[model samples]
Target chain A: MNAIQIRTMAKDFILKEFLPGERPENLTDSTELITDGILDSLATLKLVAYLEKSCGIEIAPDELVPENLNSITQIANFVQSKQAST
Target chain B: MTVAALHEYLEQSARRYPQRCAAVEASSGRQITYGELDALSDQVRDHLRRIGVRPADRVGICLPKSIASLAVLFGILKVGAAYVPVDSLAPPARNAFIFNDCGVRAIFVEASRAETLRCELARLAAEPCLLPLDWSDGPSPLATYLARVEADGLAVDESARPGPDNLAYVLYTSGSTGQPKGVMLTHRNGSSYVDWCSDILAPDENDRFSSHAPFHFDLSILDIFVPLKHGATVFLIGEELGKNPTRMASVIAERRLTVWYSTPSVLTLLVEHGRLDARDDHALRFILFAGEVFPVKHLRRLKAVVPRARYLNLYGPTETNVCTYYEIPQTIAEDRSAPFPIGRACSHVKARVIDANGRDVPRGQEGELAISGAPVMLGYWNMPERTSAAFHVDSSGRWYRTGDVVIEGDGGVYTFRGRRDRMVKRRGYRIELGEIETALYRHPAISEVAAIARSEESGVSIKVFYASRDGHALSLIELKRFCAHNLPAYMAPDWFSHQQLLPKTSTDKIDYQHLMRME
Candidate 1:
C-alpha cells in the first residue's frame, strides 16, 4: 500500500478503536488526531502492530515516539523509513 | 488510631461534601454523592456485621471498579476489619492465595468472577465464600446489605476502633513467595501517606480524578480514596480501556477530569493511538504514576501537550505504600537517559543504601535500598520468620530494608537501578514467580507451572511449563487470557510457553535459569 492508503487505513483504525464519537473523515490536519485525546500511550502497541503487519516494517522499542505515530500520515512515513532502512 | 481503620478518610469526606458528587462512572454516567457514599459504607458495615465479621477480621472484596467496591472497602475499615481487595481480572490461583493466606472470613464476588472465585474457593484450605452480587430484579445485593446496615445507623464505635498502630489492610503476596504473604498496613500507615500526598496534590472539591486502575493494585489507594477524602470528585473509567483507547479519550474529555493516575502502559494507549491532544477541554492538571518505569520517550510526548501539568513518579511496593516520589521537572523529559532516577524518599520515610553486610553504603554507591518510616508494612502475615527477615533491625530498631538496588546520590537523591532479588515490577505490579506457581498448583491441570518476569511489563506474569491431563488442552493465548481473568491484570502472565519436558538446574530444581532465556 502507498502512503495515502496506509494513512487511510490507520485513520480508520484509530476512528473505530479510539475516536468512535469523533469520526473525522479526513486526516488532513494530522495534529487533530492526537491533540483531542482520541489516542494515548497504550495505543502505541496497536500502532506498532499495525505498521509491522501492514507494511512488513519492524519498529524497535527505542524508536517509539509521537512523531512516528501522531497520525496515520506519520506512521506511514515511519513504515516507509523502516522499509528503506532494511 | 489503629492503622486498620478506614473511617477516617470516609468521615472526613462525608463531613466535607454531604451532597456534592464524590464518584461518577465516566462511561455509564452513574454518580455517587458523598452523603450517599457515607450511607452506602454504613450499609457495607451492617452487612459485614450480619455475617459475624468483627474487628481485625479480613474480608475479601472480589469485585470490579464501581461505587459498591469502594463502599465495601470503607465499610470493612469502619468495623476495624481490613479489606483485602481482589482484582477479579487476575487468575483464580492468584486470588485464591490472597483469600486463603489472609484467612478471609467472607468474599464479596460478582457473577462475572463467580466461576474463578468458586474454583479458587474450593481449593482454599477452609474459608466460606459469599457471592455478594444479587441478580435479582429489585435491589442490588450489595446495595440491599448496605441499606439494611444504614438503617441500623451504626455509628462505628469510634472509641473501640483501632488506632494508628493497627493494621488497615493486608496487601497479599504476589509473584514468587508462592503463597501470597499479606503486607500488613495500619490506618496510620495509609492516612499518614495520604495526608502528605493529599497536601502535595491539593485537590479541590470540584476536581474530578480518574479511578481507572484496578482496586487490587496499590494505585487504587490514591485513585479511589484520595479525592473522596478531599471532597474532589472521582470518575471511574469503564473497563473498556483494555480493548479500546478512543473510547477512553472521549471519557477523559467528556468527564472534564482534572487529575489522572495509571501505569505508563495505559498512557501509551492514549497518546500513541487515541490522539488525545486534539481535545478542547484539557481539565487534566496532574499525572501521578508508579508500578513501572515511565519510558522517557513517552514522557516527552506527554509533556509536549500537557506541558504545564505536574507529572510525578511515585515509587514503592504494596508493603511501603509509596516510599519515594519525584516531581517530574518539565525540562528533564527532553534531556533524559535510560533507567531514570526513582527520586528521593517521601517525607517521614527515610532511605539508606546498604551494602551486603547491612552497613550503610557511601553516597552514589549502589546498595540495597532500605526504607524505614511510617509507610513500611508491619510484616508479612502468618510468616513471622519471613517477616523478620524482610524487616531488619540493628542494635537500635531504626531501619527497614527494601530489597531494591539504588544509588544514594549527593543531597539525598536516590536513583533506582534494578532489583536485589528475582522479584520484578511489570506495569507497576510486583511479581514473585513463587506466588503464581503456588496458585497454579491448585489447578487440576496436572503437572507443573513456572511464572517468570521476562520484561518489565511482564512483572508477576508467568511462562507456565505444564503437561495437561488427558482431554485437557490450553493454548498460550487462551492460557494467558484465562490467567488474566483469574489474576489481577498485572499479576497475569503476558506470554505462555508450553513444553513437553521441564528444564532442570544443576541442583535438580526446575531450571528457571533456562526458562528465563528470552524467547
Candidate 2:
C-alpha cells in the first residue's frame, strides 16, 4: 500500500479501537497519539500487533519507542522504511 | 536499633551507609546518596516548619516520580505530618477533592501542574498553600524556601518527632460513593509490612530495587522504604518508561536491578514485547508481582526466560498492606490453567476466611478474608462510619474485612475466589464501578447508568451501559471527554452502550448478572 493508504488504515484502526467515539477528521496525520495519552500501554501494544499482522512487518523491541509510533505520519514512515529495507 | 517513625529508616541508613547510593532516576541517570538524601530531606523539613506546617498536619505531594519527590516524602514524615500523594496525571478536579477532603495545609506540586491545581482549589472554601517543587511563573519555587531555611541555620526540632501510632500517610482509593476515601496508615502500620518484607526478601546494600509503581500507589510503600531500610538503591522509573515494555526490560538489564516489583500486567507486557531472552546481563534476583492474577501461561513463559529469579505473588488491599504472599515454585504442570494461590499470611498479620456471620469458614469453602495485625490501616480518614463498618470487633480481635472472598485450602493457604463488592482491579488500580456510575450521573444527557467490569484477554475492561434522558443517543466522544474531565484515566470506562431501559431484578435493583450475560 502507498503511504497515504497506510496512514488512512492505521488512523481508522486507532479511532475504531482506542477512541471509539472520536471523529475521523479529528485525528490528523501529525496528531500526537502517545504523548497526548490517546493511546496507553495496552492500546499501543494492540496497535503494534495490528500493524505487524496487517502490514507483514517485524517490529523489534527497540523499535517500539514513541519516535516510531507517536503519530500516524510517524507510523506510516516507520512501516514504509521497514518495507523498503525488506 | 528501633525505628519509631518511617523517616527514621533514612536516618539510620544514612548513619550506617552515608556514602552509599540511596536513589536513582532511571530515565535521567540522577543519583542521590544516603547522606545527601537525609540532608536534603532535613532542609525540606525545616522549610515545611518555617511555612507553619505542624505535626499531625496533612501535606499534599503532586509531583512525578523522581529522587527529589522521595526527599519530599521523607521531609513530610520528618515533620510528623502525613503525606497525601495524588496522581500528577489525574484530573485537577479529582485531586482538588482529595486535598480538600484531607484538609492538606500545603501542597508541593510540579511547576507545570501548579497553576492548574491552584485554579481547581480556588473553588474550595479553604485553599491549600501551593508550593511548587520546580521553577514556576508566579510563586517562588521550593528551592528558594529551602535556601532560606539553610541560610537561617535553624536547629532541628526534636519536638516534631512522631510516635509509632502517628499517621505516616493517607492513600486514597476509589469509594462506592462518588468521592474517593483515604486509607490512613500509621508509622507502625507501614514499618510492620516493610520489616516483614525486608526480613523475607533480605535485600542487602548491594541490591538494587526498581521503583516501578508511582508514589501515589500503595506498592510504592515497599518499593521506597524497603530499599532505604536496607541501605539499597531504588531506581525510579518514570511513567512513560514504565509504559514501554522494551525500555523497561532494557532498564532492568542496564541498571542491574536485583529486586523488581510491579503489577502482573506490566510483566506480561514485558514477556510479550520485551525480548527478554536476548538480554542476559540482568541481575534480577527477585521478581514480585501483585494487584491481579498472572495468567499461568504467561507466568510459565516468564519463568522460562528468567529462571534464576525468585517469583512471588503478594496479596493485599491498600487498607491491609501486604498481608499474604505466595512464592512460586520451580515448576508447574504443562496443562495447569489455574493461577497460583495468594498463599499464607505474613508473619506479622493474621488472616481468616470468615463467613457472613463472621465465623471461620470450613476448609474448601469460600468467604471474605479478614486481616488483623500491625499492617492494618488506622482507618479511613475522617470517615468514622466507614472505618467502623470495615472492621469486625469480636472477642478474638478487630479484623478488617478485605471485601475479597477466598477459599481456605490445605495448610492454611488461601485461594482468591473473587470480590464480594463492585470493586475491580485493572492495571493494579482498584476502581469502584459505583464511582464511574456516579460520575456519569452528573452528565445531563445520562439518565441511568451501570458500570460492569469484564475480564478480557488483555485484562479487565469496564463497560458502562446507560440510558439517555431525552431518548436520544449521546455522542460517545462527548461522554468519554466528560469522564476524562472528572475521573482518572484508569477509572474511565472503556466501552459505552446505550440502552432504552436497564434490566431490573424483582428487588428493584439493577440486574448486574443480566448485564454480565449480555457481555
Candidate 3:
C-alpha cells in the first residue's frame, strides 16, 4: 500500500482499537495521540503490533519512541521509509 | 541490639560498604555508590535545612525515579522530616491535592517539570519552596548544583534524626470520596517489615533487586528499603522500560537482577509479550507479587518459564506493609485451579478474621481481615474522623480494618474472597463483582478484566470491560457464554466493552472512578 493508504488504515485501526468512543471524523491526520493521552503505553504497543502485521513492516525496539508513533502522519511516514528500505 | 532509623541505617551501610553500588538507572546505567549516596544526601540535607525544613515537616519528592530522586528522599529523612512522594507522571491535580493536603514545606522537582509544577503550586494556598533535584534538559545538573553548595562553604547543621514514633513518610492512597487520603507511616512501621525481610529474605551485598513499583506504592517499600537495609543494590526501572516487555526482559538478562517485585498485571505483561521463556538464563531468584490477585493461569505460565525462581504472594493493604505472605509450592503449577492463600501473619504482625460484630469467625468461614502490629500505620494524616473509623480498638489490641473479605482456612491460612464494599445487590441477590472479574479472567482471550455495577432506570446491572490478549479479538457473545458456564445467571455481566487499556491510579491499581466515568 501507498503512504496515504497506510495512513488511512492506521487511523482506522487506532480509532477502532485505541479510541473506542471517539469520532473518526474529529481525529485529523496530525492529531496528537501519545501526548494527548489518546494512545497510552499499552495502546502504543497495540498500534505497533497492528502496523507490523497489517502493513508487513518491522518496528525496531529503539523506533518505538513517541517521535515515530505520536501521530498517524508520523506512523505513515515511518512505515513508508521501512517499506522502501526493504 | 536495637534497630537504627531509616537514614541511620543508610549511614551505617555507607560506613560498611562505602564503595558498593547502592542504586543504578536501568536504562542509562547510572550508578550511585553508598558513599556517593550518603555524601549527596548530606548536601541535599544541608540545602533542606537552609530552607527551614524542620522536624516533622512534610517535604515532597516529585522527581521521577532516578539517582537524584533517591538522594532527595534520603535527604528529607535526614532532617527528621517525612517525605511525601508525588508521582511526576501522574495528573497535576492529583499532585496538587497531595502538596496542599500534606502541607509540604518544599518540593524537589526535576528541571523539566519545574515550570509546570511552579504554575500548579502558585494556585495552591500553601506556598512551598521549589528545589530543583536535577536538570533533564536544563542548564545546571544536580551534581553541579551540589558542588556549588559545597564550594559556597555552607555549614551543615546538626542532624535531628527522627525516632521510631516520629513519622517516616506519609503515602497517599486513592480514596473513594474523590480525594486521596494520606496514610502516615512511622519509622517503626517501616522498620518492622524491613527487619523481617532482612532476616527472612537475607539479601546480601551482592544481590541486585529491581525497583519495579513506584515509590508512592507500598510494594516499593520492600524494593527500596529492604535492599538498602542490607547494603544490596537496587535497579530503578523508568516508566518506558517498566511497560516494555522486550526491554524489561533484556534488562533482567543483562543486569542479572536477582529479586523482582511488581503487581501481577506487570508480570502477566512480561509473560505474554516479553520473551521471558527464551531469556531464561539469569540470576532471578525470587519473583514477588502483591497489590492485586494473580490469575492462577498466568502464575502457572510464569512459574513454568522461571522454574528455578521462588514465587511468593504477599497480601496487605496500604495501611500495613505486607502482613501475610505465602510462598507458592512447586506443586501449584500442576493444579492451577487451587486457591492461593495469603498465608499466616508476619513476625511483627497479628491478623484476625472477624465478622461484622467484631467477633472471630470460625475456621472455614469468611470474614473481614484485620491486621494489628508495628507495621500498621499510625493513622491517616489530617483526617482524624476517617482514621478513627478505619481502626477499631478492642480488648485484645488495636486493629486496622483491611476491608478485604477472606476465608480463614487451616494452618492460619487466609484465602481472599473479595472486598466487602465490592458486593452489590442486584435483583434481590448479593453479587460480588470480583467473582465476576475472576470468572472473566479465566477466559483465554481476556487479558485484563474489571466489573462494575451500574444502576440505571431499568435496574442495577453489572458492566464488564476487558482487554483482549495480544493478537486476539474477543466477542461479547463468547464472553457471555463463558461467564454463564462459570457463574450463575444473575452473576453474568449485563454489558461488555472492549478497551485498549484501563485507567489506573498513581499506585497502578485500576481506577474505578475513571471506569465509572466511561459510563
Tell me what fraction of the real C-alpha contacts between chains A and B each candidate also makes. 0.00, 0.24, 0.09
Model 2 lDDT at residue B341: 97
Q: Could you tell me the TM-score of chain A in candidate 1? A: 0.79
Off by over 4 Å in 2: A1-6, A19-38, A48-86, B135-145, B148-159
Candidate 2, B359-477: lDDT as tens digits? 99888999999999999999999999999999998999999999999998988888998999999999899999999999999998888999999986667889999999987777665
Evaluate chain B of model 1: give its TM-score: 0.87
Tell me what TM-score chain A of model 3 achieves. 0.95
Candidate 1 regions exceeding 4 Å error are A1-86, B1-4, B111-131, B135-141, B145-160, B241-243, B333-335, B396-398, B436-489, B495-519
State the TM-score of the second chain for every model: 0.87, 0.96, 0.82
lDDT of each: 0.70, 0.88, 0.80
Best-fitting candidate, measured by lDDT? 2
**DockQ (CA atoms), all models:** 0.03, 0.31, 0.22
Which lDDT tens digits does candidate 1 get at residues B332-394?
644565645678888868777888777878887789888888778888888888778886677
Question: Where is model 3 more than 4 Å wrong at Cα?
Answer: A84-86, B137-140, B148-158, B333-335, B422-519
By DockQ thresholds, what CAPRI class is model 3?
incorrect
Interface root-mean-square deviation (Å) of every model: 15.3, 3.7, 11.8
Candidate 1: count of backbone clashes, pairs at least 3 residues apart or interchain: 66
| lDDT at B356, model 3 | 85
lDDT of 2 at B107: 93
Candidate 1 residue B55 C-alpha distance from true site, Å? 1.4
Error of 3 at B409 (Å): 0.4
